[model samples]
Structure formats: C-alpha cells, structure tokens
Target chain A: MNLALHDIRHNVSRFVLTAVGIGLLLMIVLGMSGIYRGLIDDALVVVDHIGADLWVVQRGTRGPFAEISRVPANLEHRLRAVPGVASARTFVSHNVQREHLGKPLRMNVLGLAWPEDKGEWVNLIAGRPLGQPHYEMIADASLGLPLGEKLALGKDTYTVVGITRGMVASSGDGIAFLTTRDSQAVQFDQSGEAIRLERAARVQRVRVNDVGRIQPSFIERGGGPSSSIPALASPMVSAITVRLSPGVDPAAVAAIIAAWPDVSVHTRDGQEQLLAYGMIDKARRQLGLFRVLLVVISTIIMALILYTLTLDKIHDIAMLKLMGARNTMIAGLILQQALLLGALGFGIAWYVGGFVFPKFPRRVLITPDDLWGLAGVVVLISVLSSLLGIWKAMRVEPNTVLS
Target chain B: MNPPPDNTPAIEVFALTKTYGSGNTEVVAMKDVSLRVAKGEVIALLGPSGAGKSTLLTAMGLINPPTSGRITIGGRPVLDGPKPLVDLRAFRRHHLGFVFQKANLIPFLNAVQNVQVALEINDVPARAARRRALELLDYLGVADRANNLPSALSGGQQQRVSVARALANDPNLILADEPTAALDSHRGRQVMELFRKVAHERGAGVIVVTHDQRSLDVFDRTLEMEDGQLKSSQKPD
Candidate 1:
C-alpha cells in the first residue's frame, strides 16, 4: 500500500482520469440493469395489482389480458357451478386515449364487476368506490386525474369517481376502473348517424334481395336494433382474470378449466415466466447485449490506459528490480493501483448514476446491492487489466538501466 | 555498531566465468576472473567500452548469477559454482548496497524518505530508520536537503542522497557502477572522496566501476580490466 500510494501520488492526474473513465462505464452498466428490471416490473405491475391467481378467457385464446380472451357475459353463471369456485364475474378491459386538460392522456379502462368488491382489483387512494355505478370513474394517480373532473369517454362524459395508486397496466398507462356495464357500453355504442346509415344500408340490401315480398325479419314493430340482436353484439371478448377460493390448487383449477380444450390457463409463476422469458424477452436480450458491450469497452480502455502507464514507468521498475526489490513488491504496487482505481470509480459512479437516472424517461434503478455488485465487477476487471501491465513490468530487464 | 576489525578479505572471487548462448553463438563475458577486496578499501575498476566492467559488478552484486564461479561475502558463501547460497534478494538486502550512475531515488519521496525506503525494506522500524537516514544524510552534507524531493535537489545533492540510501542498512559491501559518470569533475571527486570516507570510517568494502582515472588517487586500491579479464591490482597514486 505504501509504495502503491507513492506511485499514485507521483501520477495523481493520470490516475484520477482513469477513475473517471471507469466511473462513466459503470454508470452505463447500472442504467442498463435498471432498465431491464423496470420493464419486467412495469409489465407485471397491472397483473400483480389485479391480485388474481388465475385467468379465464375464451377457450381458444390466451387472449384478453395476455393476448385476446373473450367469453359470454352469461358464462359467469356457468363458472359459478365449477367445483371450488367461491365466486366468478365478468369484466371488460381496453386501452384508450382521451384529451385531459388539453393534453393527451392514455388511460386503461377496466369494467369491473360489483364496484363495491373493487377491493380485490385496486386500492383506492383518495375517493370512494362507485355508489350508483354509472358516469363514475376511478383513475390512477399517475393519470393526473383530479377528483370530480369530467373526462370525455366516446360520445359521453364520465366523472372521475376516485383516485388509486399503483394501478398501472402492462403498457405503462394509468388505469381507470368503471362498472362492467359501462365498459360494455363504451365498447359497443355507435354514433347516431352511423346507426342510421347502417339501417338504411341493410334495408336497401333486403329490398334488392326480396323486391315486393314482405320483409318478415324487419316487419316486426320492434324497437330500433332489437331486430338485429344477434348481429349487433360482438361475440368474443378479451381474456378473463380469475381468483380461486382458498387452498384451491392453481394447476388443478387450470386443468379443470382446460377441459374445454381451447382455453389456456397459466399459474402465477408461469405467468411471470411468460412475461420475463416470452413477452419482454427481446427487451431483456437487448439489455443483456448492452451490458456485455459496456464491460468489454471498459476492459479494453482500462487495459490500454494501464499499459501506457506501465510503459511510462518502465525505467522506474527496472531501477527497482536492479536495486534488488522483490518481484512481489513490484507486482503488489501495480495490483494495488488497479484496486484503488476500481474503488474510486465505483464511489463516483454510484453518486452520478443516482442523480442522472430519475430525469430519464426510463427508470434508472441502482440499489445499494447493485452498486456493490458493480463494484465487484469493476474490481475483477481492473485486477485482470493490471495483469497485463504487471507482466510487462516484470519482463523489463533491470539490465536496461545499465545501458 | 562496528565489529572487531579482521584481516580476512571482505569479498573473494574464484574462477568466476560467465557465458551467454551456446553452440556457434557462445560469448564469454568474463573468463576465470579472480579478485578480492579487504575491509576499509575503496577500489576503482577501469575498463574500455564493452570490457565487461558492469558484468563484473553485477555478478559480484548477485544481480546476475555467473554461469560458473565461487564468490564469498564476509566469509559467507554467496555464489557457489554459479548458484546462490541464499535467497538472492534477501542476501542483497542484508549484505549489498548499490549506487547507480543516476540517483534513481523514488520521485515522490524526499531525500530522507528515499533513504528510509531502503532501511524499511530490511524491516527496520520507522523511528530508527528516520534517525539513521537523517544521520547518513548529515554525514554526506545533505542534511538540509533531507526534506526536499530528489528532483528539488542539485545533481551533487541528489548523489549525496543516493549515497545516504546505499549506507542506510549498514551493509558489509557497497557496489557503485559508474556512480560519478553523470557528475562534473568537482562533484565526481566529491562523491569519490565520500566513498573513501564511507569505507575507512564506516569500515565497508566499496567497489566502484568507472572509466575515469583522474580521481584514482582517492581509491585505496585500484584494478583494471580489459577483454573481460582483470589485468592488474595495486595501490593507486
């Protein structure tokens, strides 16, 4: 340490510059690690908040939440009959962009069943749950939705009923929950002119087909659109989120539901794996590539700088060896300098990285644990880099000093 | 502390032969060279260019082991048939000191620190090392520069620092390879007389390898080498 300190003192500016270079590289790696983690955390944030153990979607699709899952509203009655089912409900969900205070705000609207039971779906932060269900909405705190503010939803305006925290969706939009009926209305209601045009088009097509014959299907004196009951509604919907009764095995429940053969069920862990290795696999891979590149760049730069420093000290080393200094002492001097560089770099990186990341659009996460881990990496690479210089120093013949 | 003075030679070399390479490229730098130096003696080694004076000093210093030789320091077998009798680095640390042509002091250290480093390498305590380093610096008339870095000192003062460093551990023998080669005539003679003072007063065996013969009178004894062999050993004018 003494000789190492002396050498560093002799070359203070050069050593500090190397530390700064290493610190910048460390900051990059820390940012990459945080980004990969944030993606996974954000993707599952909505599902994790949903607090459901299983999902029930249309038999043929992983759909709805994962892909596209839809089932008849009446299926909730049949699902109630399944063994071990405490309760079953239907919900509709979709993504929409609406003008909020003259700014575009993306909102994830979820039509939850029995708004009073929303406890299982979201944690209310400020307002109360829906008392009457219609025209009321609860927005996530991230949406910047003020209490009692009216927001346009399709052709109608819905008032913000309550505010909630941590209700983000997989796509990072703030979530707003409404009653299932309202979500259904938002999805299916058409404009007046479009409805009138659709009716005229249908009448024209019918007249062309039957001419003077009585149009029996439209002959009934029924309310508008009642005559087209079957054709007017969309049959399939997004997947369903299911929560089982206490102690019911997810695997077994999934198997019982899979008896329909087309629907797929995933356990919690399996769902996480899907998100980690399947859905966001590309993002993770990208971050991994970036981390590797950063490490390689740092190693090359540090090795080159260290080798240059060694070249500059060749005479000093030859003199040391020729003066009868031991090989360990010389090697120790080099290795100590390397370790000190790592230590200084890590200290500066931790501070600079923390300050720079929150301002970025992506969350830059650097935990104390992460800083320690980066320290380990820096030390390992630094020590390895120093080996090249140590080897060169050792190879310098002390006999050179004589010449 | 000075031990009882003895007539035994401080260094002896017998049949010291050093060769490099083999077959058609064999080059013998030193062939069967034999020489000895007694205590309290300052010997000058003079030779032409490539005459192998450095090799002789390095071989005697144990920096370079001879291919074949028997060399003793203070009656201890140091080199036996070209092999060292003890750990080469430890032996050198305890018994041999070197003064190169340049001061070669560690740049970050002052004169005293430079000398202290040598004593510290021998495991001396810090307080004792500081006192002895100061004393040696004072003896060489550079006590005022003890706190000054080698770069801050004049060329002569830096040489004094190097001399103080060489005597830090009270070694039995001191090897100086062209110690005065980089100094002016006055500074060179001052350094030569310092070596004589260190030998006679401190009872050390000093061997200086140099081509300069103008200050040969400062040496108690002098030797000349030519073509890798010692030609004469006698008292100088």
Candidate 2:
C-alpha cells in the first residue's frame, strides 16, 4: 500500500491539473534555454559556413557582424598577395526589407565575390548556384521564396537561382547571396530625386570652380555619376575573408596583416566569439536572469502547494502516527508526492515542447544536455520544495488523533 | 476467536501523571492515574469534556508519555515515568493499536488501503498485509465497502473500517477515543459492540474513552474520571 500513490489516485484530477500548471512554467524555463542556444546558433551560422581562415575588417572594428566595417573592395587583391594566403574574397552584407506577397519580407543581402567565389559553398537544397552574376541570386528557404522566383529590387529584378536552408543572419533574417557588384549597386542605389539633386549640385559647384571654368569638359567627365567612370576605384566591401594555403600558419599571416595600419585582422574563431559575446551578450544575460527568476518562482509555488497539501492531511498524519507509523513513513509520503509531481510536470513539458517549439518564429533548439540539466534541476527543486511539507508533518503530534 | 490465558495482564499503568506547561502555568491533564486491563477484556473510560479521560487514554496508548510513573504491556515494562525502556515507536507498532473520534482514514486511500497502511508501516510484506487487511475488514463487516474512500462510506461503515485498521497488526492492546462520536445512537452502539467483540474474540485488551453512556453495557468494566483522576471503577451489570 504505497500511500503516496494511493493518495494521488484518489485526487488524480487535482494532481494532474497542478502538474500541468507547473509543466507550463517549466516549458518557459526550457524555452528560455532553447531560445538562447538558437540565438548563438543563428549568430554563428554564417561564420561557420563561410570557411574563412581569417577576416580583415576596418581598423579597430569587430565587424562584419558585430559592428560596421568598410574596406576598399580592392583589398581582396592585397590580401591574396600576402604570403600563405591561398585566396581572398570581398565580404559585404546589409539588411533590406521589401514588400512581397503583400507582407514585409526582410533579408540580409550578402555579396558573393563572383568569378572566384560564386556561392558554391552554400548548401543549396534546390536549383543551382549563381551561373550569371548580376541577375541571379541564391536565397535561404526561410525567405519563403521558391526556386526561379524573381524579386525586383533597386531598378533590377533578380531571379532566385538556388535555395538553401538554415542560413540566417544574427538578426534572424534570411540571407540572400548576390554578386559583389550587384549587391554594391543595390546598397548604394539612389532615388531619382536624390540623383537629380546631386547632379544639379555637382554642376553648380563645377560652374563656380576655377578648374571647371578652365576645362569645361572636366565638369562633364568628373561630375558625372561615379558608376559611369570605369577607371575609378570600386565600391567598398564590409570586410575581406581570406582562405589560407595548406600548411600555412593562420596566426603568422594574421600577425602580418595586423601590422598593416589600414585594417584589423582576426582568426575565424575570433569572429565567432565577437558575434556571440559582443553582439548578443546583453540578450544572453537578460534571458539567463529570467531563467533564474522563473526557477525561483517555480520552487516557491511548489513549496506552497506541497505545504497546503500537508495541511490537508494533518489529521490523517496524526492518525497514522498514533497507529505507530514511523516518522520516515510520514516524511516519505510527502517527499514521494513532490518527486512524482515534478516528474510528471517535466514529462509534460518535454512531450508538449516537441510540438510547440517548431511553431515559434525563432528556432527553439533543445539539446540533450539542456534536457538532462533541466531534469536534474526539477528533481532538486522537488526535493527542496517538499521540505516545508515534511517539516509540517513531523511537527504533528500523534496525540492529535485523540478527541 | 482464540482466548488468551487469564494469568497475564495485557496492560498496566502505575501512578502515571501527565502535565502541560512547566512553571506557574502548570496544568495537570492526568494525575496519579493507575489501572490494569486483562486480555479479552473491554473497558470504557467515561468523563465529561475537559475531565482528562482522553489524556489518560492517550497516555496509556503510549502516544502522550506520562510525566511520571510506569507503564507495562504484556508483562514487560515499556515506560518508567516519562522515559521509555524500549524503542517506544517500534514497541507501539508491534504491540498497540489506536482508534480516534473520527474515522481519520487517509481520505485519498480506499478503506482497504487505509487498513493495509498500518501493517505496511510495521514492515509487513504487502501481499500478507493486504490479505490480513481484507480479513480484518470482512471480520468487521465492512468488506463490501473495502474499495470505497472514507467520504463515500457511511459513518458507521467508516468506524468499522477504522476498527479493522486498528486490528490489522493483531495488536495486544487497542485504545479508542470517542470512536462513535460522529454516529447516531444505533450506529454508536454498533461501533461500541464491535469493540467489545474485537476484545473478547481477538483476545486484545480494549480501552475506549467515550462520552456516550448508552453503550456502557457493551464493556466488561467501566471507569469514571473526574478532575484528571479516576474517581470510580465498576464491573458492568
């Protein structure tokens, strides 16, 4: 006659309802951990996939993810010339929002250095990688764009040549890969009114200047939009990603690059660390605090609930004591009920989370370690919470059964 | 029902005193109380409210230890004054049973489980304990209500299950405090008569502290208490 189980059987509805309430609280706790893990994974997804041995950004900046970074597009040539550097590709990314299917569609547009790097490393699940540079793009499946779908942006329409999955930026937006020149064109695209104003201002400045007066054709040549001048320098990229040759020491090459005054250099791991710790450190702390507060709240609620349950059984406890039941038996009754409640609640959270987590807008990634760690916490909370009930039970005098 | 031999007494308490609050506010709940009960005998302790009949009953049951004096059960000394000679809880589990004013059945447990728990707490094997619980409930004539929780059973039926639980360990001495207070006259007398039958047939010495005088004839002897002391003792006619 397991009294704990028998008692639960008698009040199963209330017990299960109580467990469900606790389960929902536990779900939030687990969800917090999962969301944090997903945040880190989302932050590092591009960094892990880029296959870069080193990153060269603007001097003293953490970028291209944690902060703004800009380097001359031709820096790729300089990086490739360095000893031990096998190849260098220009990296540029910026977020853009456009109306699609009457809903706001946001994406992080990443410029792939074409001819040398044509997004071949992207895990394409549908269609082919960029075959034509300017008018073709590879997009993450999360953008809800199917293969061959054409998206019009900045006076140009790009056909989706390929689709990938799980490729998202730190901001949780889907990523789209386009040629470096096309991306730069889109990033620096100006409205017709702004372009007209800029042209008028350049013409007025040329009329007022001595060089413009002496060489009137110079105004037409130099004042024209920079894109019309093919000999001018190229647009800036966010950073430069370098792949090291086999047997080349990344640290030695990085040290050499670090000596240059124009840019900062970082190993691949450093970029990941900067993204995880620098970009989302406050969010992590906030989530961790919420998790701690929730656990404490859960412990308090369970303690009060168990204490009330013990109070309800006061007379029965006295009767059992008078009937010569040992103190351990009485304590076991409360302790076992607490443990069972925790186990049932955790089971509910685990089972229901499987269905609920996928529906969240952001990924809720529950790892095996997270599951095991939460289970251990639940057990510890149950044991600690039952202490109030056990104390109350032990204080009940057996003579209370009299009269 | 097997009868025990007459020579050995089931329980004996000598000059037992129980008091509450130490200095200045001292209140004696039981004073200089001494009595003996033989096996196969049922005795009733009668008193008004606050007369300490319950105090004496609880003291004799080994639930509330007396402040002073001695207690012996089955010819073995168990308590000398307030101190215990043996492991009191272990001894009580094996040698004594108790019934309260209310059925006091653990509400979550069915009647049989309520009875079975008593045996289980004594380290009795579950199967054997369950079998004995069923037998005791059947003997008490509440076998049909074995699967029902206490709330679902009638008051008389609940008391019968309570009695069965007390007898589950086959204890030598049973103490009941106002066991029939919640039942009507007919049910009250029935519960009292059940106690008498339990005592005479099972050879257990039963002491019942009750306010109801109508069931006096069901006991082998009656003891009256007043102002925390035994005022009189008489064999029932």
Best by TM-score: 2
Model 2, position B181: C-alpha lDDT score = 88
DockQ of all candidate complexes:
0.45, 0.77
| TM-scores, each model vs. reference | 0.87, 0.95
Model 1 score (lDDT): 0.79
Residue B237 lDDT (model 2): 87
Q: What do the candidate models score in CA lDDT, each in turn?
A: 0.79, 0.90
lDDT tens string, model 2, B80-123? 98898988888888899888778888888889999999999899
Docking level of model 2: medium
RMSD of each: 3.7, 2.0
lDDT of 1 by residue, A1-403 (tens): 2788887887799889889888888888888887777777766776677666776777655546566566777666666677876776675788888677789998888887764355344778888777666878889888888899898786778888789876766666778887777777777677888877776776665555663147556533222563455545554345556778999887888788778765666666666667667777887899999998998888888888778878878877887776667888888888888889878887777778878877765445566676777878888888988899999998998666666
Model 1 chain A weakest lDDT span, ten residues long:
A218-227
Docking class of 1: acceptable
